[model samples]
Target: MAALMIQGCGSDVGKSVLVAGLCRLFTNRGYRVRPFKPQNMSNNAAVTEPDEQGRRGEIGRAQALQAMACRTPLSVHMNPVLLKPQSDVGAQLIVRGQIEASYQAMAYQTRKATLLDLVLDSFRRLEEEADLVLVEGAGSPAEINLRQGDIANMGFALAAQVPVVLVGDIDRGHVIAALVGAKAVLEAEDAGAIRGFIINKFRGDPELFDQGRREIVSRTGWPDMGLVPWLAAARSLPAEDAVVLRGAADGMRQRVRIAVPILRHIANFDDFDPLQAEPDVDLIYVAPGQPLPADSDLVILPGSKATLSDLAFIRAQGWDIDLKAHVRRGGCVLGICGGFQILGRTVADPDGIEGRAGSALGLGLLEIDTILGGDKVLEPCRGRIVDGQAVYEGFEMHIGRTTGEALNRPLLIREDGSGDGAVSADGRVSGCYVHRLFDAGTARAALLAKLGGASEGVDHRVAVDLALDEIAAVLETQLDIAALARLAGLKDIPT
Candidate 1:
């Protein structure tokens, strides 16, 4: 019956990282612990663990990290509402472990009460089963405007009667102001629910806060948990969002270098995880500030929730200019999902399905036009590269329908007529809706040749499972497990 909520002073203030730390902390103590976020507005999400009845829910990466910390099977009930960005003002809503529908912020706000009902239902289920549920709040509850349908923070706190531990990022200059403002922003009733506070990501000496800590406790009347310094290896946790999942390619090949054009809304970029399993290849992320390396063996344009918008940004950065030059120089390019959409001639959002103003131009690399399709395609795929340069199979999730004369040039072939990706003639560049091409041995080998990535002898799944277990082990090492049991109020139960 013990539950604690973690709410941040603001977005990207390390709330996700804090829950990840606590997940390990509580799990090490031998108590069963889980993570919860009543509603999460993130494109990053995890496929839930199957229950006895084989049920599935839409838990975000935060919960996945917690489950990994506990070394437990992930559960669907951990997150009840998952909102994936489809456009600037619109989101695709997933409630109680399933896709509900896409809605604009205005429409979503109107249905906030209904969303809260779903959140409460998920919490009740977790309360019935787990020893601890560490809930994570989205954005800030201090924004009184959104609190009306607020299942994410204070509203959930009040409904579940869960104790909260507000976390402030000292790395940000507004730590004191954020803490004080939080106390002032909430109604007295909501503010009283915060039982304690923690300062995260401190760089200097911990004692520097000796005086500051006292002042905060005196001002907010909340106890101090601890000022936690940054954990350098925090990246070991399973990445719920693909953007945070990259590491240098582990290939042993000395000459291999790959450039990844970091899409603004990259989704499931974890498909590249095994590339990091090798020891030889160097992985470099190509962001807005830098140009794609012409000398690099390959360039990758990853998936995106908003392909058209990202395409515009890519053009703004003049990356499209660089991409054309890289292609002419014989450097290979790979596109996935929205990346696939962008490679086409144009992207049409006739219905404003993706929340953009209207139809938009694409990167015009692949000779195709992608129409925004209402039906979302989600399925694991398998394929064979008919041509010499490419072949792989993975999952596909997108809202665009691509049409092209060259679309029939499949990179891989399965027993089924179509598998995952398609290849064009000459095969210098190719595209797919799949996320993890590195997962396939044949595929990886082919791509390594193009990207100069080195390969490991291990199968992709074995490597992935090993990496996941390794991350889970970190939770055991850093967390105060026994302390968590006491905090969860489950210290007396038989292990």
Candidate 2:
């Protein structure tokens, strides 16, 4: 029952990617490994199996990918507490993959203490199943303001008795100070839990940073695990944050321009990563105040953590007006999950699942109405394109049940004899609850063909696997893999 926790100096410091790469590295060495995060604050979720009574669960997308890296099935225990932000001050709480409650920041802070036991219970269950458990911590343990009820960082490490390896992002600059300052500020018990530190995303020669590394080791008394170089292969993997949306529009010379609006509460925007990788596609994530490109071939409304709120937000940004003009100009429109709910005639939140209990008028692009109050549908599904034979695989994670005339012209026909989503009569507008809808090669090609763009059609799943292998190969050379294994108390190391 060996475990190692990867905490970071700050958010987006590559803790998730490091844990994922290590998971693959150890699994390749014939060790049974599992990835766990006691708490995750992200809307990029993955759907998993239904419970005995036919209810499904959701976990963060990073954990889902790490599960793949470990060659294991996805489980809710991989991420026990998920916080999906509905607004700047509030988020929906999920416990062990089930929707628990939605709370404001202060309210959640007070409530998190109650959930720590559940988080450790899940960690214990995972420990019983795997030889090595790679745990990823959320935010930074140095966040003293958040240390009181902190199930996300050092608190969880101390409670679970897992050794911690602090990761600092060199690409973000001030790596030395960030690492040292963390050690300086943390309470002694929390600071003592840190066993080592790793500098990630280094650009230049490693030898140049020798003095800097020494400074950190001398100051913090933590050994250097490795200085991980920037992994370009990580670009192929799905990003877990909307911050990646900033530069996603750059380096686009492709003929077909697919524009997606960056919603404030955007979730599962990684649905477009495969499109971004396509040679013939220019995927532009339209920022706020930036209108959807009028000449673009397609405008996709991506999933949102808060459907009604984001729908209103897009309207405020006047994107709805741009979408109408784009539709009139013959540009295609596609909506996924929450985005799909917004394409309908109306969205009703009678039970206030998203926010205040009320009905909001939708974009009216599809002849449907959505009632947003129900057990969230969370399941992986396989289906064929409604008007085409191309098969596609994706998962659904939404709380709305849609009903209307447009449903008669569903966008997909599930293998289970069920239908999903809807398509407009002219075929220019469509919507579906599926995320990762573009991961299938044939389906991606067929969808691009509708916009008159040629697609070489790379299977996204295959691309992810190759990227994982590439990362593992790099970490094998750069990182002290044997030292890490020993740190995790792995006794029978594969040569």
Candidate 3:
């Protein structure tokens, strides 16, 4: 089986987007393509397609999007080692789609070496089925200090014997130095694994950087595979890292201003992408030390990796006060997953599932209470929006059970007649476990209409698909796809 890996000089250097574009580019050329990442560290996750025994697993949301680009079903094997951060120095480890254990930063370094076999096993399985697998390296291979047991980048590439194409972000400046310096710092064998380089997010005339590109090639002895211009379509896709959240919100005011307090450990933040895509909706990610916008039409408490911790974070930012005042002003509030748990009267983490064994007072916006400790619910579901005619479909990926008087009024009614979330008596406050709820056009439109904003009739899923194609078209012209295929040892790509 053929495969190639895309490694970047650093995080957010467009490695994920490049692999995604290539997946679509190759898939469009009639090849059976697949996306693979030996390891991923992110809170943004997605449930994979069910197995023969009807079991679903989780992978990074970026891998899920890349799977869509390949026109294939998501598989946990695509991202075998997922690190969902619970704190700055700790993360919950997932291996082969199942929660393994939690580890601190230093502790995980020792443990990662043991998982190489598992990562390789998953890669071999994917090789059995795909014509070509496009592997995405996490962070960067340039961090050679972590090189010993690193299954994420160079370690995985060398073990899998996959040739890599280095990607550098020109938009960040120092493009030539970044690319050449990486080759300089890497061990000789590791440097040999890199076959070529691509300069990403170039803004100006391509010719303006021609000499710069030559300098990188001259220094590193690697071919210049491509120089990709900044892609506006990338904004339509889900971001994998929270680092992107810095400077995330635009300064412009819009018809409907929705404020989202950026939780320290936010998860599945892509849930609001559809709303952000709407022209009339301005989704603001309120940072710490900043107050939630007073003129906001809605305040959405986003999904959190650590519910109890983030609930305290809300209080720390004084957003708890802002939220109550917003509700008093007749503004709407919505929460999903951990955010849903935070809306209730109390959140109990008895088994210490997400830190200490204790309970804390919730925001008291809803009558419900949540107990964190249960088998995680991971399944695709569809239902009617309670109190509205709009039908919605999304996945449920959360751990815990909620109950309260608010259950008397559900936010959604699953097709199986089971309720999924709580609705406050006044209806201004609500919460649910379903992620991607707004992807449903009717539901999005209904919610926006209630917020006094027009939806513009955009089908978010279709728009994402179009965005993938748009990205692929740009890559097809900008990048040397034929050279990449050749590097992967494929016979000439189908014209």
Candidate 4:
């Protein structure tokens, strides 16, 4: 029944990575641990098992990775409220892993109050099943402006009665002020919930920050948990936010240039992590106003939370023109999930499932037409590239059902005797609903070969595990694990 919540001074402060590392560290000590986030605002989601009602749910990708770190099965309750942004002012609300509704920013502010009970119910269920529940808070609790209906940070901590550890990112600078400022602004009850503070992503010697650490402890009366050094292994992990998408394409030495447009509502962009690790590949994330590199060997349209909107966004950016030109130049094109939907001749959303009820013209690269409705497909799949013998495995998470003449030339044949994706007659264009399509060793190599590049043929899943282990090892040496265990109220400690 013990729980500890990791809240941060601001967004992108590495709270997720810290929780994940701690989860792995404690699990390695033979403790049953689980990761939970009462609310998450991100489009990077992972599909989990079906609930009691037989409906599959989706959680934030970070929680799914933390579940792997804890060696536990992922549950929708791990992340009860997910906000998938569809536009600057609106997002689709997901309650217990199923789409609930879409609301504008101001509308959601009033609506979130009603969902706090649901968040707590999920937390209690998870608490019942584990020895230690590690909770990750979204954004800063210091936003007293957001304190009224806040289920994401201090509000959830106080409601769930979980002790909080405030994490500050030193790499972003002003670590001392950020930590102290949080204490200064938070209401007494919320401020008192924080038991300690941990400074993360420190670059230089920890000793140099002794005075700064002492200043924070003296000003806030919260003990210094530890100052964690920079963890390079975190780079190998899938990024859960688009903030990391910047500068990803800079300074590449690889021969094969593969470009991906950074959509406004990009979902599950982690599918390219495997390609990013390839030595012979240069994975460029093309931002708005930046044309898809003409010298690129391939252009990939990544998954998006809002297909029609992003399709419009690409057209507005003139990327569609760039893509057509790239195709004419013999460059290969691949689309995943929402991206796959856009490659077809037309996409119909009669029910307004994604947005306004309407049909949008697609890129017409594939002879398919997609109807955007139906229960979202959420399941693991195993198959092989139809054009080659390379085997692959990944998960499908999309709401569109596609059918057309292009079905006769599918990109992949699932093990379940089903075909999943369309391929062009000339074999230069392909699209599929599968995410993590490049994680399999043989499949990655085969795909690269088709684009005239050689792959080292490494299994991405194993690489991710090794990276987690490495981070856990670093945490073991840097953090006060015994103190953290005691803070978490672990009755028994393993040697």
Candidate 5:
């Protein structure tokens, strides 16, 4: 078995996307490939396949997408340690697909060393079943302050004996300095782990950067793996970080305008990827301090990692008033998981699972109340719009239970005859706990038709699959795939 790790000079340097492209590139070349991330920090997560006991776990959404690139089922081992941030200073820690505990930033720094064995164990398990494992490193190895108990970057690469390739985002500028600076700051052993360096997101003619490429190699003594151009296909893929949400809403006028008020702790924002991909629909993310657009046909309340906290944030931003006004103006309103809870009359946190043990008044859009304490529900399910034939499949991953009179007018009916969400008495407001609710073409089309627009009827899953292949094809021509294979001890791959 062979493995290679992709690390970056800093965050948002495209390490995850590069590893994903490589995973598909190698998998297309007839290799059994798997993806591994020693640790990940993001609220965007996906449910993995169930085990013998019918228990499903969650992993970082990027790892889940990489698994799709490899044509493999999702597994918890793909990401051993996941930190879902609930606040600025702390996060809820997940290990081996289960909630281990919550820890503050300072406390987690000291506690990471003990999980090295589990990270390695998961990597080896993937190696046992595949010819190659594409590993992704979080943040960067140049963070010497975090080098003490790091399990994500140099620490995991050195321990797993995996060759590393450093990636720098040229589009962010200082490509040469970023690559050389990483080598300069890293300790000797950590620096030696990097086998080569790749320049990513180059936006001009390749020949224009020849001198720059040579300078990076001349300074770092690492081989120039490749200079990849700006990959337009990447825009079609789901982004796992909240940073991407900034400036995401292009203000282009279209047939339908849907506005989502960006919550402070928004989670699973990618649930709207399908809607965003539609050419006739304009999906806008209303950031803090910005008023929700009055002209929008639909106002969507997105999922949040910290419900009560973001609920309070909503009120602070005066969006709660905007929503009430929207409903009064006869505009449509739809809420997602945490947003669904927020649409209710009350949201209570009895055990303090998310933050403080308290309760907050909801928006009162739906006649429901939610209590945020319980065994999290993480399972795949199939359902259809209540009294409609637009069937769809999605998953439920939440830690609260909601109930009330609105459920009597369910928005969706599961295949098992259970109601999934609620509908308003006026039929203008609705909410559900289902993530990826719009992935199905029929489902998206049905919802858009109600908003006085027509959907192109694109299947989001199929589009993502095609996008992965498009990225792999680009990497095939722009990258040194053969050299990357050689670095991973894979010598037989055709050039």
Candidate 6:
């Protein structure tokens, strides 16, 4: 059966959410549906079950949400080529679940066509196996400059021969122009894929869009796919962009509030997501002007995409001073990934990895200094928590080598007999390059124990999973499930 493509007029135009809603909508109507993105550029990702016996890949937040909606196991092929942007120009490419290489914007553009086969293969597999395949297109197809060989939008639609439903965000206030312009700009043949157009993020009464919808249809000659009222519940959805979304904060030892300074290059900020699941803990973002929330008991410095730059920003905010005071006042401080580097000696970007000409001074917290190296650390690491710490076996994916610091009580000890991560003498100010520590139940329990909690009934992961289930229900209800199922042409499935 032919797939249904959710093409967008532009970025952030609600393609991902629409695809997700359609997936849930289809599933509710008794059809097994799946989500597919030919190519995704996101740093926030999930490791997926491999395909082709071992042709591995990474799962994305959108795909993860889809899987949870369809109630299927997550697989890497769902999103084959992921570009995790490390800097403004270049991104780390994860192909089939491995760091294949990194590419700059222009250099990568010419090379992207080579990936079309993999994206098609993955999409076709999902199409063949699932009852309905809901494919999402990236950006706008009217990008004629790139559309010549584009694999993300119209190029994908034409190649796959799928019917497209264009989406325009009304909240952006250019809904009509975005829709009509997209129609006017695309090649006559390229525009054939568009079956209809939908207006999303409608704020007021549905009838208010009657005239606007009529005008769009009159001008574009595209059928109306309904002006979807904004679903306020969408804010509860998990974020694929770490820049916009937040990590969870759970288990504070009462009267303990942790402040995590949002960084310019913050990566995997979702590390704190599970932490937010806790009822007793309060998580606050410490902006430069906003003095650290007065109630803050712990200050967390998160990972950054650019270690050197973010470290410099951290110090500039006088947060370095605030953090020092925090330590003096017997407050707790934790740093992760790039933040871990900042806590150590100077972050040297000698090769100009982070655009730095040379090495800079460290925070004088840990005895270590990190030199931005050529190799990137990307692997699932597991080990025992240092002699006694709140963290557990976690993963590490950073660039740079950390050396120095005392070893009595480490943050994590490798089962292979290597020691990594650092904790202070008082065990309050600590740093680790690992993310996902919050997802570790043992670590959460340990944190609660430290905070004087009777958290025996609190299972953080379970709470999150339940929230997902509720979200799935919401997606099933507000979305047009029956039409989406008919669109996918999936055969009936028994509940």
**Pairs clashing in candidate 5?**
none
Off by over 4 Å in 4: none
> Compared with the true structure, what per-residue lDDT tens digits does model 1 show for residues 1-495?
778888988876778767766665556656677778888877765556554465555457677666665567767678877888776678878776566777888999887677777688778887777778888998888888888878889999999888887888888777888898899888998999887887777787879877887888988998777776765555433455444534432233356777777777776666666665556666677666667776777777888877777888898889999988988887777787788778778888886655654777777677677898676665556666655534465556667688886587755666476544555566777787776667777767766755545576455755444544554454444334444445456647433
Task: Write model 3 residue lDDT over 1-495, tens digit each, in one string.
Answer: 889999999999999999999999999998899999999999999999875567788999999999999999999899999999999899999876778778999999999999999899999999999899999998888898999998999999999999999999999999888999999899999999999999999997899999998899899999999899999999999888888888766669988999888999999999989998998989898888899999999999999989999999999889999999999999999999999999999999998877767999999999989998888888889998987778888898988899899988988999999887888888899999999999988999989888888997666888889999999999999998888898997776653
Tens digit of lDDT per residue, candidate 4, span 1-495? Answer: 878899999999999999999999888888789999999999999988889898888999999999989998889999999999988899999999999899999999999998999999999999899999999999999888999989999889988888899999999999999999999998899999999999999997789999999999999999889989999999989889899998766746578899999998899999999999998999999888888888999999999888898899999999999999999999999999999999999989899877778888999999999999988888889999986789999899889789999988889999977888999998889999988889999999999998889998989988888989999999888877777777778788543
Candidate 2 on 1-495: residue-level lDDT in tens? Answer: 988999999999998898989999999988889999999989899976654455678999999999999999888889989999898899999988899989999999899999899899989988999999999999899999999988999889988889999999999999999999999999999999999999999997999999999999999999999899999999988889778888555545568899999999999988988888888988888889887887899999999988889989999999999999999998899999999999999998999888778888999999999999878787788999977899999988889789999999999999987888899999999999999999999999999998888777779999999999999999999888878878888888654
Candidate rank order under lDDT: 5, 3, 4, 2, 6, 1
Residue 388 in candidate 5, Cα distance off native in Å: 1.7
Candidate 2 residue 327 C-alpha distance from true site, Å: 0.9
Candidate 6 TM-score versus the reference? 0.82
Candidate number of the best lDDT:
5
- TM agreement with the true structure for every prediction: 0.81, 0.98, 0.98, 0.98, 0.99, 0.82
TM-score: the better of candidates 1 and 3: 3
CA error at residue 261 for candidate 5, angstroms: 1.1
Off by over 4 Å in 6: 27-32, 50-59, 142-145, 242-255, 277-279, 288-295, 346-359, 369-394, 406-408, 412-420, 440-442, 445-479, 493-495
Q: Give candidate 5's error at residue 172 in angstroms.
A: 0.7
Off by over 4 Å in 5: 52-54
Give the alpha-carbon lDDT of every model. Answer: 0.71, 0.90, 0.91, 0.91, 0.92, 0.72
Cα-based lDDT at residue 171, candidate 5: 90
**Model 6 lDDT tens row, 143-257:** 8888866888887778877778889999989899999998898899888778788788788887877898899999989878676767655654656665453333232446446
State, as a TM-score between 0 and 1, how close model 5 is to the true structure.
Answer: 0.99
